[model samples]
Target chain A: MAGDKMLFVIVIGCGRLGANLASGMSAAGHSVVAVDSRQSAFDALDSRFSGYKIEGDATEFAVLQQAKTVSADLVVAVTDNDNVNLMAAQIAATVFKVPRVVARIEDPRKEDIYRALGIETICPATLAGRAFMASLESTPPKGAHNA
Target chain B: MNVLIVGGGKVVYFLCRAFISKGYSLTIVNRDSAECAWLARRLKAVIVHGDGTDLQILEECGAERCDAILAVTGHDQDNLAICQQARIRFNVQRTLAMVNDPDNEEVFRKLGVSAAFSTTRIITSLIEQRTGFEDIINLVPLEEGKVNLTEVVLRDISPVAGRALSDIALPENSLIAIVTRNGSPIIPRGGTVLAAGDRLVVITLPENMGRVIKLLTGGR
Candidate 1:
């Protein structure tokens, strides 16, 4: 879908979401640079992933500098820790002037504040919670009601 | 005054004691259950057991009414998040955060943290000041680095070493605060003579720090 423009992408946190996005974007011919504190997290990237990996804390400016975040058109922060995602995303948005930045915040309540700071936020908790609630309404799970 | 402190450790314990002495109300939040119990038993402040960065935990701590919030977590990101949440969500008047990385001090301040101090910055500044210009005894960046408290040691190489304070042309907005000679502090005056080994504590703007040092040390 992002094929219209060849963009440079920086994905912080090489976890499941980060790996998948980096792999897919790289496969789509976008230049992808993935960063993670743990070197092992790079293993999650798809075999076709041609992006570069930088093992470092995304919250640090030096690491982002090493990742050449200044040239990034899009930055995605999906670390397990919401705080890390918030800090890293803010740096990419404000400091590096990335065109688009997204952060994964598990807490739905924090989405507004994150957005107010000019960073786009995705709440996995709220998304899953809504889907699970909808399924419960349709299936009428008796065991869940009793438990 | 009411203060809410996020994250618990020796810093929290000492902070609580200091605030208690000043008769300020205190609330401390920490994630570890054992640390919370320990802090609760020792300090007079209320100890909250939960992630300090969690907005719910901060709200439960009555952050909305807290006069100040201090986030001294080991992680810089967590501290920044806690301070951001306190300022944005709770609208806390004053939010202070401990930055683990010295570089994050400016970044945190840019991101809306009221005050971001780094022990690493202080230590590194001390080392750097001591290393360079061996004549500079100590250097402290005050008022968020806008003002500098610089202590310079006068030597024979200084042009104004033996001159009276009034005779030397001190830069504008800069003053010699104190002069210490032979382990004795002397309030500087127009008649005060600069000795070769005298320690002069000069207060100056960061931009004028170099000029002040150059004027005193007779360096280019």
Candidate 2:
């Protein structure tokens, strides 16, 4: 951990996905700050996670400022709401000028908008569909005669 | 002028009617296909079915050629993104957004949205005005409520009622622009003497508004 450059990361939202990402990043020796509107969302993070937790709406500019997003090297917006994630990610990328910004959007159709803004997006629905299709393609169909 | 309106709701319907009546061309982009069809059937404007926050949808709606973009989505974040995209990407001259949260107004302004209106705050202020805070009635707030134009009514018991404009100490950066007595408007001057029932139109910073009100209303 001494030789590795610790990246300062701000993760907006503390849902299951957000919490897991925060904890993982923290475990990887990165400085992480997790933000959520509800204080209870922090419970999703494991006790071993030592990253900072901020209870506030990530869509707020002031809250982001309080989270020290201006100095953040990477910002991830994983809020359950697509609009909230998009707004937080855009603020990180465009307003705060963060070098790397990513948002989690449920609707895969919104990928174009995120792309146009030059923000990366992860859609669980699309990911799951592709994963299921890949698994199905790898396995032989049932009741098929041996070739 | 051509205008691109994003989202669908009562506000969109009313805006569509108003803009169409005024002979302005409108193109509405709504994610709800049913609402888009409803708007298409009722209004003469073109309807595009897609998420308004999507830049591709907005481009399909011809946002670049539009004179203005109105983002009135229920979600404040969506409205912010729509307005920002329209302004920065499409170069729309005017971008108006409906702010669901009053606290986000300054942030929207800082992000370069042409204007953001908080309906909740406006209604609250209207109710406050009706509650009759007699000393001063705020006429308008400009620059995110930093500067205000207010009407101050001078009562008979006011300390400055009989004082000349020069003698009465006004708050810093505050100016008495005009005076109305018995429905007659009078231009204010240094020698002008304030009287009971005189309505004064004052322009001042918001922080100094209270001091100006206290001085004019006899410290009430």
Candidate 3:
């Protein structure tokens, strides 16, 4: 998202997706704070990632409080653990009243309940499953069938 | 009543026993295979080996029509997910959760769990109550404060301190469910005697709280 206004963003879980988003957003000039349980997870962030890094369990309220979630303009939960992501996202949305909160939920069945709670969810399984289904359409590009 | 309990641990066995004795049909959902096997051998409830947070597992355990769902998992997040999914997807009216973090009790309530209990808060309250007051040690609210549970210690000053439960006329809608005598809990029966130094766990309505406390502690 590009706008003239800069936003304070908190990314929970410094996994591959979390680190990439934190680095990208930081490079884009937004204030970013990346949180992870393991300090080594920060190694994945790009050196150009000028965002602040805090190592702790993002699912914990204390960690989010230390990350200044109360003033966060946006919070993203991309942890590998579905429950952790749900907890972090819900706390951001309900407890801290963050404006925008999104979570990566691997279980597609849980997406509806997450949305019902006023939080957005990205389910990798559903997204990837759709992509696989689209690939089976068997429509080749121009001249690709000849190859 | 049919109740679905998630998580297979020591609490599961004891809860199973308690509910079974009460004549309620039960089902247990657990993630650990070995624990599931052990629970299957030890308990009389249907065991489903899967993550309780998953909607499919709850559906497999017949959560849709169960009278209540209890999430006693060790993790607060998992417990919240289980209860939330049970309520949202299955439309289970009564859902209780064991909150691992004492602070998340309010959070769980706000998130739509029917009731949330925290052992840490209870134990902390007991310890603090021992140091804080002579009687009426701790108070906990449930069902959005529609009901209240209080821990009252019977002292020499108490009016009903030396009487049996059958002899005392307790306030309407209030009951002394458990009596903790010298650190052990005894479910108060008709013949159970209440003595000084016994801790009473009383469940009552919000309106009668003060009167119940006064009656128990003779503090009016």
Best by DockQ: 1
Q: In candidate 3, what are the lDDT values of residues B1-220, reduced to their tens digit?
A: 9999998679999999999999999999989999999999988889999989988888888999898999999998898889888888999999999886777777778777888888998788878776856566557786676888888888899998889889998889999989999889999899998999999989999898899889878985
Candidate 1 local lDDT, B38-96, one digit each (tens): 98888888888898888888889999999999999899899988888889899998989
Taking the candidates in order, what DockQ does each have? 0.63, 0.31, 0.45
lDDT of 2 by residue, B26-106 (tens): 998889999988988899999999989887888889989999999998888989878877877788989989887776766
TM-score of chain A of each: 0.88, 0.93, 0.91
Query: Which regions of candidate 2 deviate over 4 angstroms?
Result: A1-9, A25-33, A37-43, A50-56, A60-75, A80-82, A89-147, B134-139, B143-147, B151-159, B165-192, B195-200, B205-220
Off by over 4 Å in 1: A1-4, A129-147, B124-133
| Pairs with backbone N, CA or C atoms under 3 Å apart (clashes), candidate 1 | none
- Lowest summed lDDT over 10 consecutive residues: which window, candidate 1 chain B? B129-138
What TM-score goes with each of the models? Answer: 0.87, 0.71, 0.77
Report the Cα lDDT for candidate 1. 0.88
Q: Model 3: runs farther than 4 Å from truth?
A: A141-147, B131-137, B146-220
Clashing pairs in 2: none
The CA lDDT at A57 in model 2 is: 87
